[model samples]
Target chain A: MTTTSETAQAAPPAASTVPPKAASRAVRSKNRIDPTYYWMVVPVLALFAFFITLPALVGVFFSLTNYAGYGDWKFIGLSNYVNIFKDPAILQSYIFTFIFALTTTVVVNIVALAIALGLNAKIKWRTGIRTVFFIPMVLSALVVSFVFNYLFSNTLPVLAERFGVTPLATSILANENLAWLAIVLVTVWQVAPGATIIYLAGLQSVPAEVYEAADLDGAGSFRQFLSLTLPLILGYLVINVILGFKGFLGTYEIIVGLTGGGPGMATQSVAMRIFSGFTGGDYSYQMANAVIYFLITLLISVIQLRLIQRRGVSL
Target chain B: MTASTFSKPVNKMAPLGLKNRSGRTRKSGREGYKVNWWLTALMLVASLTVLLPLYFTVAMALKSPDQIGTGTGLAWPNPMNWDNFAAAYVATNFPVAFMSTAFVTVFSVLGSLACSSLVAYAIARNWNRRFFRGSFVYLLSAMFIPFPVIILPLIKQTALLGLDNPGGVVFLHVLGGISFNTLLYIAFVRSIPVELEESARLDGATTWQVFRKIIFPLLAPMNATVGIFAFLGSWNDFLLPQMMIADPALQTLPVVQMLFQGEFNTNYSLAFASYLMAMAPTLVVYILAQRWVLSGVMRGAVK
Candidate 1:
């Protein structure tokens, strides 16, 4: 090592005395490891481990026991996991969560994309209108739900009754089959602003020259949009869909505010199921359910990262 | 990307459109297109989806119980019972809940800014180190663990540690945000030239001193981005405070509001009034800092 360092210092004229790679390696090794870097990183890492990582691991461990969130436990092996598959309530939650997420993702993207296109157009009061559109993005989701709940429950039924619309005369929140639709309406109302902002950003990134060129080629606006705008903003669409889906899968506050997961558990998301199980004496069972939910989310996140990387998107 | 990326297109394209408008009048060719009023009208109607609910909230909050029973729930109240706000404020114990929420949000924002940026600076500067690279990956992996998966155990752990309160919620909020906030900061930090830090290092500044003096000041835009996210997240959070906070009085606004909601006996006027109060701060901030908040949210979404 000493000889390598000395030779590295000797000069380029005597480069053949020692292999250049070895000298460079020795010099590189001499680069100081700052202890302050450790000081900067370790505390945050330890906190994260203690708060997030340790609990996750502990939760997974408990999924294999009959701990009841407290008391003595027996190693139950994969019984909880097996029971989860057979359990009607758990199965219903997974189904409802996936369906809700899928529907909401599709609806949000379509509405947001259309609104983004309008905002992107040459319009009057563009900034003001954009500001108005994003109001829901900043409000608490629970509050928004409660507000909409009153609208759906009281105002809508009165109007429907006056108009002689039989199907909607009563509150939809009381209907087991239609309550999820109400949740979807409120969720879309609150969530569309966020997806719209993302869509607007993506739309703004596309160069105006692309549209100008299309116009010169005798393409109409619709043709240009389908051919040029859609392809360019597809990355944002994919992102909004995946991120929105992942987010909506953890739908708790909105459901609680709207239906309290009632009308016979019709709107209970996987998150609600897990949370309710905590107080419902189904702790280890729900932990198992939670572990499964975690795996699904992990898989989706992995896929999202891969897609983003492949598309060369920074986020 | 910076906040300016959001408005750059509008600034650039508006002048182009104006220039095209002048040329189009003279030539009458396909140099420009007119503003589509149909789309504007459609969007205006859609905007009611946002406006009507808010209008309903305000109208409901101000209506007397008698007026609420008489109308289709759309008319503005003439007498305008302003007493609901006063009543709901006292019933929800608005001051305590608001302060608790403010405490959690403020600390969460401050802690996230301090801890995540420090971690990012260390990792970004020492990118060649294996341990630093490993740490970044470890932090990034936490994003995949859904909060529900760990929430139950977290409640148990925090209770055991005597943290079943708003303080614990603040701690988790900061810790939970580190992964994404660090991701955002690392990307931004990599863009900052090392020469800036090298000068400070040559001045014999320790790592902490260099970070505090030089890098933190330069991270203002990212600090805005991360701080906005942390504030909004901690402020609006329901699940954490609902399940984690043991004392009813110590709970944050969202959880307190949830508890205040009892069936069959709920006064609609008071409930709506309470929601409006809880929503007021977010609305005020958004109105005051519209540009920065909107652009900050946009910047956060893609990166």
Candidate 2:
């Protein structure tokens, strides 16, 4: 996945043109170690090893123990992992997270792709409209979720009452069966703009000549899009889907701000479950959940890398 | 290839019929380029819908408690109650929270840039070496690991090391950001020509000197992109600071504001005002740097 040689071939020509040749020359002349380059990299590697790698390894180890967050512990030896399968709350949160992620990924991609196509067109106020759509992407998730929380709890209910719309009178976040939809809605709202930007890049990269050829072939707009645009941007679509899905798996702040996993834990995500463990004294148990989450993300990332590498090579 | 091919016809045809249909001619054949007024209106309406939350927050922030309860909250506040901002400012300990947030963002951005760029520089420059190649791969693979996966032990580790403060969060932010920022910098570094570094090396500059004088300066645009990204990630972060910094005094803007919301749950105007305050810095930064932010995000995605 991290093949430098492949990247050199795939990278755009302007910046990488001289570096590969220069690097090879350096390599041929010096078979020995380059202390300077090694020195330059040590700080970064040290930070990565200590903060990221070591803690990850420690986390795996902790999952086997009966340790609270602070105090000493006994070796539990997969009991927490065993309990994870049986614990209804943990299992329910997993199901909710998966459902939320899958739903949001589908909705966000479709909305973002449509908006990207629109933004890519030669429309009036294109930049202004694009900025407006992307504004939510910049705001903190907690803040956006809070604003929407108010909208759902206060503004929507008030407007609903005024219009005599009985169904809309209740805050959606408080509805046990339907609260997940509110979380999904806010997730898509915040995430779509970033996806739109990617799709816009993909849209821009489509050759004009290909579109012209489709036009001459008498393809309608829908046919042109299906036959030309989608295939061309399939790579970007895969990237967005995998990244979006993985990101939504860690849905924390949005859920916290909007629903607080409320109305009988109907909207709880795995992340919420894990963090809530810190205060609840189930630290090691949650570490096991975290390890599982890690593995799931890692699996998705491997698939993403494979897809990207294939596409990268082809491009 | 596409740009040159597409531009040639437009350039040649400019003299014949350029003035009247310059806009139309630029994208003459594409259906999306046509002047579809209805589609334009639809898009505008959609933009308004997307902006509604932001608009509603501002409106609610300006309303008084009585007006809000009276169900005129969506309407503009009569005489626009600005006192909500003052009240929220005091309630949320806005100054301390704002300072903490600023401190984290500044240090996180700087630390990420410094560390990631150095790592990226070494990898990009030494692309042929086995060690650097392996290091690059190692760093890039870390992108796959989510924060929650490590947060359990990271919290414990921070406590043991006595780094579980705002400063500790800064350390985590910088280190956590290394993977993505390194990826971005590596892409950008690949684009930079090695000629400048080569000349600097030829003039007796050490590797450090070459990077500092030539490579680092050329990475200014990428520095901005990575800086903005790091800034956004650190400033808006909730879970890390919320978990690591237990002391209310050391909490950042988002976490503090979340607490403020809980405390002021029924104080609708004050809560909305604090929400606006929490989001104001990022929104202002976005407005000022939308072009860079948009382009950087797009570019980052493609990578």
Q: Which candidate is the best by DockQ?
A: 2
Report residue B187 deviation for candidate 1 (angstroms): 0.8
Residue runs of model 1 more than 4 Å from their true location after superposition: A1-30, A309-315, B1-34
TM-score for each of the candidates: 0.91, 0.89
TM-score of 1: 0.91
- Residues A129-212, model 1: lDDT tens digits: 777898898889988888888888888889999999989999999899999999988899888988887777677567656766
Give the chain B TM-score achieved by candidate 1: 0.90
The lowest-lDDT stretch of 10 consecutive residues in candidate 1 chain B is: B11-20
For model 2, how does the per-residue alpha-carbon lDDT over B113-215 read when each residue is reduced to its tens digit? Answer: 9889999999887898888899988887788888888888888889889888899999999888888888888877887787766556544456778788888
Highest TM-score scorer = 1
Q: Chain B TM per candidate, please?
A: 0.90, 0.87
